[model samples]
Target: MNRERLFSQLVSHSGPFDIAIIGGGATGLGAAVDAASRGHSVVLIEQSDFAKGTSSRSTKLVHGGVRYLKQGNISLVLEALRERGLLCKNAPHLVHSLPFVIPSYHWWEGPFYGIGLKVYDTLAGQLGLEPSRYLSREEMMELLPTLETEGLDGGVVYHDGQFDDARLAIHLARTAVNNGAITLNHTRCTGLMKEKGHVIGVKAECVETGRQHEIRARCVINATGVFVDDVRRMDDAKTENIVAPSQGVHLVLPREFLPGESAIMIPKTDDGRVLFAVPWHGRVIIGTTDTPVEHASIEPRALPDEIEFLMTHAARYLTRDPRPCDVLSVFAGLRPLVAAKNAESTAALSRDHTILVSDSGLITITGGKWTTYRRMAEDVIDHAEMIGGIGVKHCVTHDLKIHGSATVLPKDDPLAVYGSDATEIRELTAKEPEWARKVHPKLDLTCAEVVFHTRHEMARTVGDVLARRSRSLLFDAQASMNAAPRVAAIMARELNWDAETIDHQVNRFQKLASGYILEG
Candidate 1:
């Protein structure tokens, strides 16, 4: 997890690695872990901080694709269901089971979804959390006190996995590093290194120091989510684009909007998409509108229409309607969906991953959900070994314990998300009393967490700490903006930044936080 040590390993190694992966999001990080654990010398490079893109901007659900199941994608649903169960077992500190109530306005709605969810449960088999069952109108209201009850006949309650997406991404990177993989953030891949029309390695440059390295490898993997085509074109200018970027947006609201342990799921929205209002880290996340986009950006903005769509739907389900001013923060993520020929809408694209080996032997893996990243990694590495002539090493990640995996954390502990690492962080507060002080009055982030992320989590920028490491920006945009000066000061002390750099960090973060605020 130490950036300097990892960077040294990248440059000092003379021989080619077994695998060199481009992209540090879910799929790439997963592949790094899978390959390294199997005794392959692996290196993974990212253009920015890990999960700075779509991985951190998820709706925070790790479940079988419910909408895909309705679309008759049984194979994907089955695969995701199995992976969901495994993730809960593998990363117990980050993943947890939660209940979701699908409210039914009409009587038939309850029976219809009830039967459908039963099939969903049957597909999960022994791995199912709790069986889906019908709940009476009175019972449903008790579970969801904030739900609108006028036309509510009853509801069907089901089970799904919930987690902190960015936190999980960090754990995956740590797991890969623990298995001896070289993972470098803020390193951009400039171009492919080919030998006589065969892919060999990559030309990468350190974003911070501008030092370039010609990194050779037996195999190179392009797992760069939505921007996969951008890397593909590097290998061959005539490479056909496989990814169709689909943008999904979410809005954060106060806990009072939900005020319960259970979540509400609208099975079918007006646009035939599913919407979820899930509780996470003491805030309610009401989201997700999927809209087609022509291009992808590292920081995608929540469109006005997407924001309005979520608020409109939130008003329909919640007794307390939300306003544009009520929005605490808004964020968006782009899905790296493999384009389908003649596919009318991005919604129709499959969640299953697609693997392509170019004529030059460059392996590209794109198009998969966060829930099934492990399976996608296993599949890609198996392909890499076959093409690269590496000896067979069967996948061991199915039972591999991710870094920081531990028993259930105490419910009141705020740092429970850090799992076993929470004990070390707690010790920091005891050693340095100033570290215990909250950075923002409205949020629980503290100076110790900021320092910890900077030193151990490869956090180099203020945005890396606020946006991904601690999730302060996603929880409350204005509070994070107000807290930036304090966070930057703490980071400056740790990273040895001058007064000018500190001011620049604070100002830069404020501008970034402004995009998350609707009024700004």
Candidate 2:
């Protein structure tokens, strides 16, 4: 999926493709893999870098919706649970099982949640990761040493799954490429190409070069997450908006806040939502306020009140109060909640996915969470094949391993983002010792990672390297800012950029990094 290969494929392909997919987030990339693996000719376009929006900003859990179970949404819970296990088996490098505990404040809380979680495990059937158990106060304290002890009772412990969302998206894109899917980033779909009021193809333009092309296809599928309505309107100007965006925010704190491997799940927050303090990338990720948003933006910022809400909630559960100064980075993402009439609030909206087929043959999929992206993709392809009159085949992605997921070998570097590909990266570092050096003094992100992702992972900007590829920006924005100059220099060398372009990259990265800083 190098720049040259992607560009060459885009220019050389001269056929009526079986399917054309818009958006390069989780669902779009997954559908590309699904269709291509099933022996269909497929092409996908992304306006910006892949996963630059909602897909990358997830809570990073691949769990069966335990909260959904509480609301008696058994079907959604069961489906998510099944996908959770499947993802763990398919992408063992990225998806791993995690133990979660619901700390209790009342005596009856233990039995109540413990029974509920047991039923959750039962729903998973053969796909269950682990069984649920009850943890005593002493045991809970041992796992969550920083938790507030005065009002604490025992806790209910259960198991779920977790992963790196952006990394998974990157791997999906690579997997799609391996399966013969034509994928291009920085390419925007301007409008739907129609013939006799049927969607025949798409009119796309490269955002970087302003070059436009008409990619004719037998069918067009829109998987644009929060922006599905925009594409739907292109197919039919009278299309009704189906997406109701809801904002969720997360804050990264020092790992000491959640020192153990087990994650703490607060089943009920003051705002009637759930809170989780999970350990990820050597840091603790802890708010997810469900505020209704009228619009969706790529780089959404956390509000001052949202930051205060998270801090106040943390103070209630933890012995140590993490001030705004303690926040390493804060980010916000919008969930594309499918609009339901009489749904009082966005929180009341279902997490289940919605797929709609317009009269003009546009298949748009939206409203699913990250845990169920694979199934959503499979469904999209199935619908597309039906509408386009292609010979549909069974999906192979349920068992297919993503790119660089084969090897189980371990690595010395903690920041080694690629699991099985660690050896290849290490070999590169041996040839160029400077590549092994950390870009910033305090960060373990090495120079080799910057070079590896730029040359292979379709990394075109400093933001892609530090933010998504290396995850430095998510951990510490100030440190990421410090590392930007070095990252930009290496990218300049790899992409053959001039001094002005390098400066521009650094400037843009710095602006993005600034948004992650929480107010003190």
Candidate 3:
């Protein structure tokens, strides 16, 4: 489908849409796709760029939570495993199986973990992904030579899926658009439009032009993740604080630091959290320290204590000590967990999502992981349809094909399609060689991708392109800073932005990126 034409159609057309979804993260985007594919007129609005929140800041793993199995949450694990397999099948290019090694120090450790993993595989059954296998010390060392071999008896190797979380969200958005959903990024929902006592639509501001628009829909879905309570407050003052925002931080180290093909899954850390050293986009991503967070923000900054915690835990199994100096980048994300009445810690909070329709009639869906977004969307739509009295057909997103997703790889792969750009990039290497190296070595990211982001993917600024569309900023901040001028120049030419506008874009990007650094 022509996205530009569809967007134009949405802007010109005015009526009560079947569904209007808030937030552009995985849940909202997935809901949009499901609703649109079912023949419902849908509009999705986000305050920031899509996946700019917790959705993008994931561990990038699409696996059954192994730790969940240890906690006897077998149902959650099985469901996640099924979804992981489905995602891998649906988006082969974006999602691929990643083998992980769980190193065991004691002789019994291997068998014990192996048995658990075997149970994990058994739970998945045919739906289960590739089974886990026991690997000897020699085999483990072969897979990951940098692993600390001292007292290492053996290891368990298992396969789990990995994906570009932002890319997947983008694909979901595109799919929704393809199925005729109006998705507006940089659109902020300021208030809920109430009729008598029922929520009928939303009052939103376009972040770009600061223009206000009233979107009328039969049902307004507040799938704003952690901000669910804030949205709910518009209708009822006594809306329970459903979400307990928990902070999870990750540290990015150079690939040379790990030097391995497979990731290492630390089941339990000393601090009562699971740790993972996953290979992601050419960098070693060691993370995730879960702590309580009171305030919720778009950009969640990682604390120094969190970084030190990760380094200390990772050091236990690694050959070399990973210090703060070795850290390339650090990021933090807030998980919108449902607050349990008797829960002691955030780790014990339920990952399962909850959907609530308030007395004033605002449908809110929150507290779920990236892996179950589709299912969450389905549930949200089902709830919205019932509340709105809209008789929508069954969901078709289960078998829907997302935009830019192909069941088969093209004959001209990444190298072939990007080779010429690689050469041109090499010719201009001195000016900005990393740009060329990333795409083709001879060519920087081809003009096509940039155009695609703006024209189709709803990228409004240079930061959107670098940070989300291409991910140049996350990998190499300095290089992204250096390449900003060139990218802005390209954007200015296409978007017809004046010099002042280009400068504003560049400055905004710099200021936003500055937050990633550890301040004294």
The digit string of per-residue lDDT tens for model 1 on 27-113 reads 999999999999999999999989999999999999997878888989989999999999999999999899999999997999899
Number of the predicted model whose lDDT against the real structure is largest: 1
Order the candidates by lDDT, highest first: 1, 2, 3
Instruction: Tell me the deviation in Å of residue 514 in model 3.
Output: 2.1
Determine the C-alpha RMSD for candidate 1 after optimal superposition of all C-alphas.
Answer: 1.0
Off by over 4 Å in 3: 1-7, 407-448, 518-520
- What tens digits encode model 3's per-residue C-alpha lDDT throughout 193-286? 9899888999988887888888899999998998889988877877779899999998877788677669999887888888999987767989
Model 2, 1-520: lDDT tens per residue? 7867877787788888999999999989999999999999999999888898999888899988888988989889988988998998888888888899899889999999999998998999998988999999999999889988998889988999989999999989989998999888888999999899899999999876799889999999999999999898887778788999999999999998878788889999888999988888889998688888887887888877788888899888889999888999999999999999999999988688999998889899998989999999999999999999988799988898888778643323474458777776788899999899999986888898888888888898899888888789988989999899999999999999999999999999999899998765
Count backbone clashes in candidate 2.
0
TM-score of each: 0.99, 0.98, 0.92
Task: Flag regions of model 2 displaced more than 4 Å.
Answer: 409-416
Reference-based lDDT, residue 335, model 1:
96
- RMSD values, in order shown: 1.0, 1.2, 3.9
Number of the candidate with higher lDDT, 1 or 2: 1
Ranked by lDDT, the better of candidates 2 and 3 is 2
